[model samples]
Target: MRNRHIATALLAASLLLFAAGCKKKTPVAPPPPPPPPPPTVVEKAPAAVISSFTAEPSTIVRGEASTLRWSVANATEVTIDNGIGAVSASGSRQVYPTSNTTYRMTAKGGGGDAVAAVTVAVTTPPPPPPPPPAAKASLEERMSREIQDIFFDYDKSEVREDSRATLQRNADALKTILSEFPSAVVSIEGHCDERGSAEYNLGLGDRRSASVREFLIQVGVPGDRLKPISYGKEKPVCTEESESCWQRNRRAHFVGVQ
Candidate 1:
């Protein structure tokens, strides 16, 4: 008892200072909820817009045809090239290119691709105009363009009553050139005028070509298509002793044989 050990060591230091001031502070775990704020990102949508590509007759002429209009926006797929594949975004197509061409268009979605181009022009065609100039191929060139020649009177030829209307218009133009050359043969030559006597002017030019082959066989021509001849006084178409040069060497001459 040293004074009861100083009051029991001051009551064990006053119960260790009231158990270190009631000892109960060990709960501080609420600072781990600040690591969950990094998850929220999503963006994508923009690219695909051509809104118009055209060629409605941009020019064409080789069997002609052209038409390829188009329009697009934020597409999901659209295409066009030479062979014009998959397409439908507001369209029209009818091409027939055979020479010059250039056409491209592509539009795709999901924010990706887009492009447009248009060009179509081609031409060439002209030639036709040259055929018209041919006609006059003989029958003695159509009887010298339709026969005509008759004269006589100075040493007389029986048919000279003004040569009976020029021997009935030379027997209607030799019956229209013997009805178109029916094996043609017409010689009635009888000319004379150097004042006769080349053997009595060949019997007065064989009675002036047998009186124009008996007036063209009484007007129906065809004493077997006539053939009387006699170049009496030797073909004197006017040796000019005059009587209008012996009436132009008395005549009744027509000749076309083949």
Candidate 2:
């Protein structure tokens, strides 16, 4: 009985082992579709290039104007510094700066960024003020300076022997002026001291003025050019009551009329 039972156990174990060997092993999966070919990593190209950046007139005077220009390629974004925001890829702008300045431009794309720069120079400005006008002479000063005045002795209307030289000089000046300006006219004024009465001095002054005018006419000055007038004691050069002052007050004055 023990032998028969051992034989049955051995046969059962043999059939189980053969069945396990005959079953097909599970097929291996194809490696999860190779992880979708690693998702195809693609590299992008570089950013835009700045072809040129320049100022039309790099050197400018103060308060003057200049144009800034630039050109870029293959960029998606462009910007300038110094208060300039986003801008086109290529363009120009007018700028007026009080001082020298530098400008920088930047370009950006999917790949990277690019940069460029330009500088504008400056010069000295014009002077703040103009030159002053030239000096000129006045007409009144010229007319008064040309003619000479003649002096006289105290209370005398007669032509003095010592006064001939002065009279000759006055006559020569008048003749020279009349020859240059045919229409020029002059006046001879007679003056006296305050010691005499107004009425008596008037006659003395008239005689003195007539004497000067006659001498000028005799020396070839036109009579019409010499107009005679009398001031009497009305106009006094010296107010002091003395011989010297009185002598100075008694004189003939020459004045231009035309």
Candidate 3:
């Protein structure tokens, strides 16, 4: 009986050890898949760029104008200095600057900024030339300047001794003027004081003018170029009743006629 009991206890112990050895173990998670490989890293692009900036005519006069031109790339906004506000990426503008000037361009984008500069040279125009010289004097103006009148004594129809020297000088001047202006004619007008009647003064004035003409002809003046006329008392130089005033009215006046 004691041996059988011992055998049964040994069998139970063996069965228990076999059941424990057949059980399965749990698995690890695998390190969470290395946190998804940290994702793919990327870098962004750079700033905007300025392609070109220039002035069409760099030099100009005071009242002249010039053209400003530019080109930009990769820019979100663009602008220019000197009253030129916002502008397109590429464009041109007309400008009139009174003096020398410098223009600057700026371009901005998500990345950074870009800048460019251009200069416009200015020069003043020269003054206009002096006005043309004055023209020469005409023939009629020369005649008025060179010729003069000769005076005579009161109530005189004949050439007086005092008037002979003046008459001779006038004859010499007439010769020179007539040589240059052959077509011009001279009128010797005889005027008298207001002393006598109109018809009587007219006859006296005629005698006076004819005597002057005869004297001019004797000094070598042509008869056809000389015309003698009488004004009588109708054309007195002075109206005052005086000898000196009357003397002024008695004279032979010379005039040029074309």
> Pick by TM-score: which candidate is best?
3
lDDT of 3 by residue, 1-258 (tens): 999999999999999998887785687676655556555543544578999989979888877889999898888899999999889999999888889988889999667789998888888889998766565344467556765555666667888888888788888888877776779888888888888788988888888888999999998989899899988888877899998888888877777787
Number of the candidate with higher TM-score, 1 or 3: 3
Tell me the lDDT of model 2 at 159: 75
lDDT of 1 by residue, 90-174 (tens): 7898899977798898888778888888888887766656555465345666655555446667676777676688678778878
Q: How high is the CA lDDT of each candidate model? A: 0.80, 0.81, 0.83
Off by over 4 Å in 1: 1-42, 49-60, 67-90, 95-113, 116-121, 129-258
TM-score of structure candidate 2: 0.46
List RMSD in Å for every model shown. 20.1, 14.8, 16.5
Residue pairs in clash, model 2: none
Q: TM-score ranking from best to worst? A: 3, 2, 1
> How far is 185's C-alpha from truth in model 1 (Å)?
14
* Model 1 superposed RMSD (Cα): 20.1
lDDT of 2 by residue, 83-193 (tens): 877889999988886788888889887677889988878777988776554543232343455555566776788778877887887787678766655666777899899
